[model samples]
Target chain A: MNESPVIELSGVCTRFGSQTIHCDLDLQVAAGQIVGLLGGSGSGKTTLLREMLGLLRPSAGRVRLFGVDLDDPDLLIQRTVRRRLGMLFQHGALFSALSVFDNIAFPLRELRCLDEDWIRRLVHLKLAMVELETAHGKLMPAELSGGMVKRVALARALALEPELLLLDEPTAGLDPDRSQNFVELVGSLQQALGLTVLMVTHDLNTLAGLATHVAVLAEQRIIAFGPKDQVMTVDHPFVTGFFGADRRKLL
Target chain B: MNAIPCLRVEPGRVVLTGSWTLATMLPHLADLQNRLAVPLPAGEHWDLSGLTRLDSAAAVLLWRTWGNAWPEALEIGELHRQVLGRAADLPREMPAAVKHAFHPLESVGRLLLKAAHNLRGVIALFGQVLLDLAYLFRHPADFPRKEFAANVYKAGAQALPVSALVGFLIGVTISYLSALQLKSFGADLFIVNILGIAIIRELGPVLVAVLVAGRSGSAMTAQIGVMRVTEEIDALSTMGISRSIRVVLPKILGLTAAMPLLVLWISAVALLGGMLAAMLQLDLSLNYFIENLPRAVPVANLFIGLGKGLCFGLVIAVVACHFGLRVKPNTESLSANTTSAVVTAITMVILVDAVFAIFTRQIGVPQL
Candidate 1:
């Protein structure tokens, strides 16, 4: 890991009207690590991920990704920094009108510098990476099943070879068998690409083998952050119930 | 990285090794599957000891070739065992394959059933909105005033530029043609009579109705349809909020208020266009055109036009919300409902216009 963190948040505050989601929260993710963010329902795991992705700004703190401040005044700097980050939303969020091929090719096409042949090759390569058949490329998003949608979404996120990947509940809807497959896929993808990933998930099985570090959010801030096993030993009530007392049931 | 992924089968065993990942870019998987499926001996063993690295993609390819299971005679260490074990459990993702052969008659029957079901859904939604309206009449606090005002601005005020442009162009064409024909008949002065009645009574209402149908009608349908897709409508219902009051009623009230105003605005702009064309083609003065306009097209024609506008607005809003709530939780359904809302609203407008023409025939037309 590098000395400078891939992602850094300091003294972050997020509030909606009278409800405060996070107050003076702080987090850091080293390079090439997969960090699973776990929290109970309404614990603001998704909100923190959004803040890190620059989708939502903290009320009173700094959010930095790849050493670039997300709230920078310069639009060009924001765009440049954002281009290096990729996000996979809870639902696929694929363009409905476009075919799977076109959806994966969207970022490349937006760049306008790649040749058609190169774009086609890269898209095919990505589809293969996610274990999708070449014929499936022509299909629309509605025709895909829940598992396929997640795979396609992962492929799209990897299109630009982003250094940091943000995932919103990567395995909320999949069956146990499929969720295991998803976890393996995410694990291998992180290793292969050397991606620094921040994932918000409730699936404990996903955190078992996939996450190098685990961050537990409770009372609007991270109560525990460390190696998955170490964090599991934390004395907090939510942490204990989440990792030790109810591990078998949750997993 | 130097180790190329390769599969070599000998009499006793199959050997696999190399950097097999998405980045490594292996050859076509199907070709590899074919080579491995050539009836290997029953006791042939597999070796992965030489493999430097393995990822899910590569493991999946190997698993698929092995008939979606780990080989019984596989010779692998604990590290490889754990890696391959994860991939072995994946349920084969069955693509949405059309199972039965295509039958034209059966397909046509299915489509008809779907249409009938959709019609029933729209009617039910309409009835719900009507019931909600009755309830609102008794208790008004449940109404969402902010949302109503916002929708009015969206569906009415913002639509001004495009509606004005379309109305003006249509008016220019209609008046220019009528002026030329009237001139040939040596009755050039009758151009005002023709333009006045048509712009105020028929053209203005119909044009505004069609424009709103395409513009605001589609927008309303799309907004509600997206809410349906994302389960926002469900959340509202779960929270003890009536969707009809919070979502549907405001749109109906807003468009109802805006449509008459839009009709009047379109009529004014259209009349201006007609006056311009008359001045150019028939050499009619502005003063004469303005002064003769009230006598040529009585105030009754304006009222009739506004009446049609109000009715058309009600139908469009109701129809848009009806189809919107009918949308399934899919992108295909959202686009489909939006298109259907626009088409249905326009058809209803034309049908209503025909009825309006017959009933108000004597009221708006000036006697010769």
Candidate 2:
């Protein structure tokens, strides 16, 4: 586990037309650790996540995930890399016409050429883990409420039993009870399944409860980053202000 | 006044017979509007053959009635057929007395036929029909079976009532029209023969296909066009399914196979109507009329009618597909495409019929 870092960003810079979002950013997330990418609305945490996912090319510097240059994949590592990753989009993005079962089965059908028996076993097991009964499989996405959708999206993303789980704004629209449940689920899944996780969020309770390591992104840089208590104790104005506002809201 | 004491007014398939001058029509306009107020059937063939006498004022009233009564905001394919359908049927509302007064070009039509001595127009029209038929398959696999069957039943199956009615009416109409003129020449007995030729050859195939086009073709276009906008089509592409082979081929095959039978069915019913009308008007027995059909109508007429049905099916399917594919995601595009599919399908059907008329003239074309 100590060979090298799983993810490394050295002086990553990104811009859009005339505006610079991320400037000379340096960060690293190690294997088997759940890291939080924290920021306010316009702070570009999502852009940095995209860079780590290899969706966006850094304007400068480099990003490496699992010792592979994400921008250029070497042929030997293609199957291992793709098979090891998963993503949960902000809105869950389930196809409305497809039933919940088919929604979870979508990625499995796309990626694995498995027989129906195996796919059914995997899908049912994951759905049960998310506490969705097998009979709920027939319901369409529109019929499900917000919490159900997130659980289903999570189940779909976890279909491959991925090593790395990248979630963007995973708990954006949930009520406090549901948000707490989701955070608990994320933690349990990570520990029980040995999943390495990187997530971007503005959820303070989630940040405090689940993240083993945390980093603040602002001014196109990682302003402060360390283990949970260390990052929380920093005196940086934005960190103090960001966490202080969250503290006030929490109280 | 030069006009007759009585005129007829109709708002779609329903009719009210009476004088429709400015004074008489003004009172009835409200009633007509109310009748037209009934929601238009899914497509254009709203059964408007009830008008026995038509005029410019009634025509404008019907056109304006369409303005208020028409649901233009629905899928364009439906609107397209309904609007064009009323336009084509409007001319029929004119009485034969009036048609003769207005149709100064009838002599010219006859002269052109005598000069050409061929049915090139029918062949060309059939070719256009084929092209239109091919278009429905643009995304074959994306077919919505529920909607397609609904449209087919609406367009093809639902058409039986009117097709029977038209055939019956055409039988009587030609009998009465011919009886009035031929009585002076003592050829009133030949009314059965004329009715037989007209309905079996032209009216039978063309009318049935037009009904099919207005009902089913427009529905087909709207169904596929909506699917295109909904990203169901995109999902098929992502799944590696060809929308055409899946969505349209079944419809095309089903319709293509069924149209010939429908045409034959419509034509036979129309001839039965003519036979009944002849018996009522000219003292001809059904047995004698049926015996005369083999010689006067011939089996080639059946073949021609069947061929026309096949061509019309092709025309309609292709036009629906073309317009459906042309529909942009916006509402305006739906209307435009639907309108074009109906108008294009009908005009092509008529033009094909005319060409068939020309090529079948006594010359080199084989009988069957």
The TM-score of candidate 1's chain A against the true chain A comes to 0.93
Error of 1 at B162 (Å): 3.5
Residue A28 shift from truth in candidate 2, angstroms: 0.5
Q: Model 2 segments beyond 4 Å from truth?
A: A95-97, A111-113, A245-251, B1-368
List all candidate RMSDs to the true structure: 8.1, 31.2
lDDT of 1 by residue, A1-251 (tens): 24678899999999999999999999999988899998999988888888998889889999988788998999988876776678899988988777888899898687665446445655666777677877888888877887788878888987766768899988887788877877777776666546788899877777786899999899988888988778877799898877765555433
Off by over 4 Å in 1: A1-251, B1-3, B8-14, B27-45, B63-74, B82-96, B100-126, B136-153, B238-241, B359-363
Give the native contact fraction of candidate 1: 0.09
Tens digit of per-residue lDDT, candidate 2, span B117-169: 32343344345445544654574445456645654565667777877777677
Return the TM-scores of chain A for each candidate in numbered order. 0.93, 0.91
lDDT (0 to 1) per candidate: 0.82, 0.69
